[model samples]
Target: MSTESNSRGNHSAENGSSVHHVVQIDASFLSEVEGKMEELPRLLNRSAGRDSCCIFRVPQSLSEINERAYQPHIVSIGPFHHGEPQFQMIQEHKWRFLSDLLLRAESKRVVLKDFFEAVAPMEEPIRKSYSETLEFDGQDLIRMMVLDGCFIIELFCKVGRIVPADLDDPLFTMAWVLPFLMRDLLRLENQIPYFVLQKLFDLSVGSGNDDPSLAKLALGFFNYMVQRPLHVLVKYYEKKGVHLLDLFLMSYIPDCEEEVRRPSRFLHLIQCAKKLNQAGVRFKPRKTHSILDIKFKNGVLEIPVLTMDDFWSSLFLNFVAFEQCYRHSTKYVTTYATLMGCLINTPADAGFLRDHKIIENYFGTDKEVARFFNNVGKDVVFDIHRSYLSKVFEEVNEYYQNDWHVRWAGFRHKYFDTPWSFMSAVAATVLLLLTMIQAFYAVFAYQNPPKNH
Candidate 1:
């Protein structure tokens, strides 16, 4: 485990126990997701739920937080603030995936065509006049990024024949590409940038397949496992009373950043320890996906930077920084309830549950989580997976009014007993707004003249 102390050499952990980090992740916890076959129905429920999400295998490092205690009741639902939904959520469950909903949209086919026209060459800086269709001239930066995305998904999800014997096979080199690609990825806008990446591919076999996006997501997670949390790695080692930050980073950081393969800005994180030391800040061991609970507060403020490994994790880190780093962070508001869910689950499922108590422990209480999820619609969670199926297959009701999602939301709500399906629907409603905008623009253009300009 590479850590911060080793890098700073001889720095003392004078008040180790009191270092209350703004976050805490049981890295060991996420690995247990494969065994979560039972928790799904409860989390994806359409009604008020009381299923305990307590995993049997959490690291003993921390005690089980008393489940947020609150009376379950009816609550109203609302829109998705989350980025594009993941493909895994689609292929495994069919229409439940947002991609399918996107498919159901009126201008879906056209939008997809537009998406392809803007993206499809497997090569980068696509030849403006390439006679061949779907073929890129050569690997451009975008193409390289797309490849990296595929490469990562191949590592985390489609890792064929990756057994215990090959888990550490240096050849895979997932870390090398993760940070390099992500740093560049952050430089652009979200949806449009993804549109470009999507267009560059030729998924003739499965036209609507979003395997690349799934790959991008998984790689994002793998990168977090490999890097960015070195400071936390240091804290972890410190807890065990052994320091190895310098040696660990020197040994693996270079490989993770792939400075040997391709020089990148990521290398600076590894080589620039002196500057961080001068500034007197270092990342503590990862508590929960790079978020940790620090007890020691010696006036050293924690800064937030996106960790290339986990998209959700990076978002959570920034979310915490928004509270801890911001000077205006209200003194009354120490932690938000949803942060706990983000800490415990994937980015997609943040506050998606119908039960509020499950998310309130780290955040504050059951009521708070319910209020947050209520802001989005209910369709995201289902009691039996049946509602999910029904909602996903339903045609995009074009006749529905602007607040139709809200209007149709009647079953038990999130705040009280609101139906989870309607809530998710509301969220989908907002995300799908762009399509409506495009339609309006097209209609306006057809009606008005270009006027010989």
Candidate 2:
């Protein structure tokens, strides 16, 4: 009986030791969790401060359509793509451009130190402009801001003829290189804040009463891509933009009244260009300040002439991506792309628009243009009631649904589509009338028994 009692005591001791070990582990885990909870406030603080984030990384749903459209090919401007290997050549040119600006600043009593000092106070705001948490430290970000900003300002000045460009500078001498550089500069990921450029410009090349403003200089450099008149561009020069891409986009927005809030509905896609034409809708090319200014009046649909090239394709893709990602942005570009996609469902639809001088197809064949629109318009989130072209869509769809118009249009298209067919139709009509008249005369002669002639 004593031995049995000793064994029970030993088992109790082992059970106590196991319980102690489990309690220790639970206490340690609880302490670790409590320690991690301390960081919640900091995370929330960072998130709350992100209201200034205007620049965004393109979301995967949009980028998956065309990854290269959102990425920089020749140059890297912002932290998202900085220090990339392929951009090293442009990185060297950035230094060269900075050197030129420094030389110019020397005459104005502005030094490199002045540029850095001007941007130093803006580091926090600059960091908050990007959507992602940047890995760049204070000194590295400041240097990037100064370098990229000055290079853009100098390039604009040189191109605008505000400052003379070097005779040997390949960026200006090589025509092909300038186009790619221009495209890269306007990319979504490849941008520094416009305020940084303005600060650098004000310090390095003080604006004169007669001299072009930074906005003007920027517009001048990118105007070739858009081909807007100077007067139209001048109107938006005073408006502040977040970055170069935003500035370029701002130029294309129509200077019209604010969009009025209307009842929301499911925005349906309209018929293709070929189908609309067959349904008695007329297509006309319009010349407007903004390409997004599309209109439908009566039975005619008017669209501004669009020049499509490789540069335009890339530009539009980025523009749509930006509108999709950014909340404050208007859906003008997105609406235009979606409208085009609705109108061009096939190669024949593209060809019809091409014949009407509505689309200048420099990108590729009609099939390619059709495919481009289809691809761009996919996976986009748009509210038609908020869109500027919502009225046009409603009118076009309403017109297309009319049975009388479609029947008449189909009849005309089938019988009188070509000149030969029209002539044959007229001749057949005349022959039928003559046959009826002859039968009536013969019936009258037989019934009345008139004298034979």
RMSD of each: 30.9, 5.5
TM-score against native, each model: 0.19, 0.87
lDDT (tens digit, per residue) of candidate 2 on 134-202: 877899999999999988888998888888888888887888878888999888878888889888988
Residue by residue across 1-453, what tens digits does model 1's lDDT show?
236644333243453433332345576776576567544333223221112110111111211221111100111000011113342221232222223223333243433344333445523223211111222234233433343333322333323222122444433455653343332222111111222223322231122453333323323333554554444333322121000111121222111110122232221111111222223322223234323222113312232222222333233222222223222222111222222222323222323221222222344343543333232111122121122111211111111212444333322233223456666867777778978999999999999969995
Pairs that clash in candidate 2? none
The C-alpha lDDT values of all candidates are 0.28, 0.85
Tell me how far the alpha carbon of residue 280 in candidate 1 is from the true structure, in angstroms, after superposition: 38
lDDT of 1: 0.28
Clashes of each: 75, 0
